[model samples]
Target: MSETYWDRHGIYGVMAEFEDPEQLVEAAKRTYAAGYRQMDAYSPMPIDGLAEAIGFTRNWVSLVVLIGGLTGCIGGFGLLYWIAEIAYPHNVGGRPFNSWPMWIPITFECTVLLAALSAVIGMLAMNKLPMPYHPVFNVPSFAERASVDRFFLCIEASDPKFDLEHTKAFLKELNPEEVAEVEK
Candidate 1:
């Protein structure tokens, strides 16, 4: 809840442009190794090792889906049990009230349904969707070439190790095509 560097300076970050995905990956790996955690890389297509280079680990969405699935499974089975044993208490063909075997289909469907919904919602929340604007788009070269042929690495101002001049010099050492400051 404290004031961030961006809040104080109106600067988003410093960005470096790379022409090749390999260069981007290498630069990202070096950056991450240099102890920079608040950084991101951009590329036109999926690069094989970029995620690993950026130090991306486990995500929380899977946990969310797992919990949602368990909730649905338990809730579905409980609903059926309540209907059969307590709510209606109906008997058919002299069968027992707790006919659990017949609940498998409904329970499975509910599990799948809730898991799928959780996946969608979790992904949206995790990715911060509905974002119509970002400071990265403010860079002309990035806006023109990010989805075309260029790759980018941006180290945000909010990073603990971020010092404007020092970070720029560090990025320069990576031999990027161009390095620019991103304004908020």
Candidate 2:
């Protein structure tokens, strides 16, 4: 038998589609109330209050940025200090050994460089980028409407409260145009 890649770590759950963005928001709220956690929502455009409805909390992007910036500042200062004090210290024109003003430019540049690099890397890591494959792509009819005029909500099988029959019935209650099973 051919090995099924998703057999072990697949999202086998029910999906709900909604016409009005408000309905989707309400549905998400109800889904959360019903103890569902591993679920996601899709819409043609941004929806107000939808994140709050689904109990979505802010990610750690800001924290990551702050830490990166601080680290960069410290690293830059440390590098410049080491270079000026120890490595080939040149007392040009009898200036002090620890020339604070002269080192500012390089320190500033290094700080900016490291902070920018960290922000980029942190964003990619937080969002789980470079994901080449996802099970949502397997939904044949789903692709057409996702980017167009429809909204979708999916509850994953891995959720603690996920039950095949119960989840399907709950989705049907949301009055989606169609409810379908998604694998992986």
Candidate 3:
């Protein structure tokens, strides 16, 4: 590809390396204050308040799970009702036409099963999981540093305020060891 193509679409973001969690958090705060959205931070371990500093508050996985559970519950109950009352209409030893008690176990199981699956699938989908490749992986410095006792903050090129030179200068001002441009 030509340099223009690389410049236009292949650059993912600019990343900076910090040695401490506090430094990373401060950098994220500064970057947020500088009006840069679409940023992310990675560290060897979770840092307290990092998500808040990065302006992440809402999560929707629980809502997905709730919807799944409700669907499962209603479907399970409806299936049992159709089987006993309408599909077969069996008179199993003078029992009630619709044995609500018998449906309890199956309904509970379905609810749990669907809720668990929803939690896992919704979380993975929301987080963009199963990601075998990413532009961040193209940054050689990130591969060695991000996972081994170093914290990295990346301000993505997709951010409205992202300018190659300006963002680079801003990251440099945060006193990172290196401010690297990540290729897609």
For lDDT, the strongest prediction is 1
Q: What would the per-residue lDDT of candidate 3 be over residues 2-94, giving only the tens digit for each residue?
A: 234335777889999998999999999999999997899999888899998889989798899999899889988999999999999999899
Candidate 2 deviant stretches above 4 angstroms? 1-11, 44-48
* Model 2, CA-based lDDT: 0.80
Looking at model 2, which ten-residue stretch has the lowest summed lDDT?
Answer: 1-10
Residue 136 lDDT (model 3): 90
As for lDDT, the candidate ahead, 1 or 2, is: 1
What are the per-residue Cα lDDT tens digits for candidate 2 across 1-72? 333333465656678878879889989999999889888888889999887777789867777777777787
How does candidate 1 score on lDDT?
Answer: 0.93
Per-residue lDDT value at 175 in model 2: 85
Sort the candidates on lDDT, descending order: 1, 3, 2
lDDT of 1 by residue, 1-184 (tens): 4668665988889999999888999999999999999898999998998878888887788899999899889989999999999999998999999999999999999999998899999899888997999999999999999999999999999888888999999999999999999999
Name the regions of candidate 3 deviating beyond 4 angstroms: 1-9
Ranking by TM-score: 1, 3, 2
